[model samples]
Target: MRYHTVIAWAAAAGLLAGAAGRGYLAPLLPPDEGHGAWYASRAAGISAYLFLWLSLAGGLLMSSAWFDGLVNRARLLAAHQAFAIAGLALGLVHALVLIPDGWTDFGPADLFIPFASYYERADAALGTIALYLFAIVTFSFWFRGAIGPATWRWVHRASFVAYLAALWHGIRIGTDTGALPVAVLYLLTSSLLIGALTVRLVYVRPRRQAPARPPSRAAAEPAG
Candidate 1:
């Protein structure tokens, strides 16, 4: 547990440093005709999406019984949690980087509040909603006990909704999608998510049948 906590803190620090360096420090150097900011935002956004995909895939793998022998369920769950938190951090950088980029008039409201920005309002709103949903889903882990098993499960399902919203947002608003490599990346991630969901839904184990009750005393006496 201590080790995991340390890892979490380290990951958080790294994310903050990376975001700050990319957003503030890099911009201090000579400008590259605004390409610096553009490229940084694009790269961060793409990385965010990749992290989110990994997190989703990890969760799916952990939930399914398919990996029974190959990996321990507990370890898989730990990694799932790590990936989810890291993905959320990367996502914050992805949106925050845009503020310093100056390419878009994305003020604080635009980034945090859904549909606040006029630029690609619908798509941006999707991303914004996704961000909040992801945060909620991640935090739900700490409150899982209080929330109860059923409610925790219901809240976790929001991750899928968040993932879909993010995917749509990236497809519509992402500039890198035009490139062959990035496009292929998007396709592969989407395919994996869909395939995992299909497997989970189709291959889930049926509930065990309850044992039959024995005959009551009265019924047995009458027969006797």
Candidate 2:
């Protein structure tokens, strides 16, 4: 019932589900002519962004004192970890699903390697880089002890960079961004993240240095 144990279980369950969906459910689902893969990729990408946003928000809340009494940090951390893992999985699905789309002509290299795809190359590269950063941040949770707390913290901070890359990628390359609802969702979530981060930074207090001890009487007298 420990947090790490819960994270491990959740990861395993996600892998199993992904495998089953790919191996069994995919063939059973009704195809949408030639655009099915494109649709699936879009949905998965959006879902991944939403989950990543949630993970970032939860982390901010966990660190800030504003929610001290109202929320439980332990549960918040568990949820944060879970969301991060889910986002990574969904991001992978988002990339992999594109391979089947004849329109995009995405191969493994195009999806995995930054700038390898000619279709909106810069934006696609941002998404690929974001995925790698996200994966590093998520997996760092398991290696906190090995890497040390300070190192882990710095690694987690990279999520902000990853988030920006994702946001840029979505805005530039996502077909759904033209829709009012999708645009609004992106705007609102990004605003929330920025606001939370601002609050956290503003409220953080610097470590107070210990007051200097008064010079000892003996040392003062012997100074001559």
Candidate 3:
């Protein structure tokens, strides 16, 4: 089977599973009783962040020679792509599940459009923007051939911006950001990604120029 086909199926499966889970839990834990949608959104948001982190980390590893012998590049690339797709899927679920939450009053425009939400508009916008950026970067994989390698690389760099936006969004607006464990998770993951990127930048060797062919004996003897 083709790689793109697998990615499409995986994304579809993820969305279906998320929708089913939300449907099952929504009735049992009503908004008045426990705010199930809110909880689900938080969980999905955190999971998506973690998946994005993994995808970025894997991409850094793929570009750097540090893991060349230790890890299989092909597998690393596959994992990176898979994680990115999973992250995008979970991100959509994170936002979509919130539609049922009565507390926030998040309409489709508020959830999908940046700065459209009245509640914590700036912070929520960051998350919304991050989601869109993630989508662009993830889908760019499918169009890499058409866009050309240079453009594809530049598009992939948008992941860094997406990561930053997500981190900021979570820290500023996340309900559980105050918790020690969640704070620690955010700190640790961001630190690891920064470290990996540093290694990639510092250790990535430039292409070596071909050595100039030594001058022939005749040329050396009588240069003209």
lDDT of 1 by residue, 73-153 (tens): 776666666666776777787778777766667778888888888789999999989888988987788899899999999
Clashing pairs in 3: none
Write down the lDDT of every candidate, Cα atoms only.
0.77, 0.84, 0.84
Per-prediction TM-score = 0.78, 0.78, 0.79
- Ranked by TM-score, the better of candidates 2 and 3 is 3
- Per TM-score, the best of the predicted structures is 3
Question: What are the per-residue Cα lDDT tens digits for candidate 2 across 1-224?
Answer: 26785577458546754675578646644576778888788777887888888888888877876677677767667778888888888899999988777777889998999999978999999999999999999889879999999999999999999999999999999987887767998999999999999888887645669999998888789654
Candidate 3, 164-190: lDDT as tens digits? 999999999998798776799899999
Off by over 4 Å in 2: 1-33, 204-224
Candidate 3, residue 102: CA error in Å?
2.6
